[model samples]
Target: MEPCERARLHAYFSKIASQFAPAEPAASFLVTHLLAERPAFVRAVAAMSRLRAVLPKPKSVNAAAQREVEQAIPCDTLSRELFTDPDTALNYLESRAPGESIVLLDVGGYFTPTISELHSRFSGQILGVIEDTENGHRRYADVDKLPCPVVSVARSPLKDPEDFLVGQSVVFSTEAVMRDRGDILHGRPALVIGFGKLGSSIARLLHAKGVQVTVYDIDPVRRTQALSQGFVVARDREATLAGAGLVLCATGSLSLRGEDFPHLRNGAYVATVTSSEDELELDGLPDVYTRTAASEHVTRYQTTGHYFYLANGGNAVNFLHGASVGPFIFLVQAEILAAIRMLTRAGLAPGMHEVSANDRAAIAATWLSYFNR
Candidate 1:
């Protein structure tokens, strides 16, 4: 970690903590975090502690870093045991802190179901939920009636900058993975699946890199947006897949299923921007295809007539090389903190709500002032 970056993150964390610290610690937080040993995240966790007691449920992918965070700030033993097992995590949380007001501070909505269960099992104990990722926000949105008030910073304008930077990181990581295999991205026909914020950024960045970018989106509006932006929008998904040399899946959902794999151009490179295997459904890959290791970060799946390359073992390619979005992500993190603070107050009804615009503007202005200086 760069010293300047660490210092900036620490300063930003302090600013958020000072601004959002509750008058009285109102709720204990059950936090789902990617414990990636990133300075921005680590310091954010520390700042959350000032607001209330936080039970950090480390995403299973980064358990080693979870141990580092645990050593830095003691977490409940049960939170560690049930980190991957969501079904039991809530039960354990209830048992550990009986009658306490708990808030679900979630990433990727991994605990959405658990929060629902908590609401049903022990009503009013769950204060509210603060979701940080678009994927998670959608999960909560799908619920017919949320069990508690849910505030999300996932789609806030403050997050747009972070999403754009994440898109850049994804493409940069993909290029690095390609270079390792003696390949280049310049002038290659690439298909980008999903034309949302991150997907649009990826498509635009790829085009700027001299890659012929073809975009596909289930939403006709987004496809039109891509077309208006001057990228070729695919009318026939299979035909577009057949023509592309590279495929980047940015949709946080299962954009590519196993049945769709055969349409891919032979030796086409496929990567995802989402952290999980939600983008490419490799489990549905046909049995006809055999898998082989192409490199540390690349996997090759082949059949007699068709084959495609999976980068970063179907995980987000950006994470393969330390998904560095720099201090920009702190803006979104600060928004999540502000949401948590808002949840502590009364009068937020049960349903999905956006982080207040005032909070968003304040956080962004704070970021610009600090980074600009």
Candidate 2:
């Protein structure tokens, strides 16, 4: 090649490689590349590296973190493999099925990986998948790409036909377990209020277990949508209170209080999977059963003609029940284990959802593994 042409080729190749730097580093290099004519100014570019650290990381980090913990970053890594892959988890869920075909309801931002696991392990036995957000829908099973039954939808549509989807669908759960607020109803007619994505999943999970379900959502649109999906919509607060099994209050918001508790059924086993105080007002109500977060989030009150129980006093419902951690890896590992047991009938040897006493140590171990520390 000619000398001038060779120099131009070298410059072009150099420019292409510089394009791959991190955000701030890329910007400074771009500036330097342009200022190469002024040699002195180009050499001063090292000063800009500090500015890159100050700028915020992309919001994609937030989404990834949400995918990790199910909520925000308030919790620690309970299981690392959940964020990594679905083998261990798929193995666990498969163990639970006992040769029976299994169904799973995944409600969150990251569900594609789980569906893939199900498709691989269960093969023909795998059912469908649903999620809340539009991104989740796109990221979920690609019906065209995969050779299994996966929904190419963000929300389960009311169009076509509303059919009853069944099987043992483990939900995108939280960290909370109902230790207090006794009178647990293992099975009966249950009133589950709030029909957003999470509530719908919980209602479906119960329905699969053969429980009579009455659904309520403040939004008429959700009620209409849920009804078309075969849910028996509860109209009156009084009628909602007349039920006989359990009452679960779940709105997307985790900051719920006693004000959000649904009117109960006669002997209802109430516990919220959303936030604990979604039942604050019903606390101490005769048949009202709930998780233990009420201790941190509830306040008692007596009203005219009847006693009004606030749903949440202070504590969060998910904190008391199973936390909404199933979507991401930290919680993902536990969910996969459940799925493996459910689908493959495999068992976890031990330390499935174990938590360490020291927070720093746990975080360090997770960080080291996540970043190869």
How many clashing pairs per prediction, in order?
0, 69
Q: What is the C-alpha lDDT profile of model 2 across 100-120, one tens digit per residue?
A: 344333333233555555556
Error of 2 at 297 (Å): 12
Per-residue lDDT, model 1, residue 151, is: 91
Query: Which numbered prediction scores highest in lDDT against the true structure?
Result: 1
Query: How well does candidate 1 match the true structure in TM-score terms?
Result: 0.89
RMSD of 2: 22.2
Error at 74, model 2, angstroms: 13
Per-residue alpha-carbon lDDT of model 1 for 246-301, expressed as tens digits? 99998888888988989988878999986545677788888888989998889899
Output the lDDT of residue 305, model 2.
Answer: 32
In model 1, where do residues sit more than 4 Å from their true spots? 2-5, 27-67, 74-87
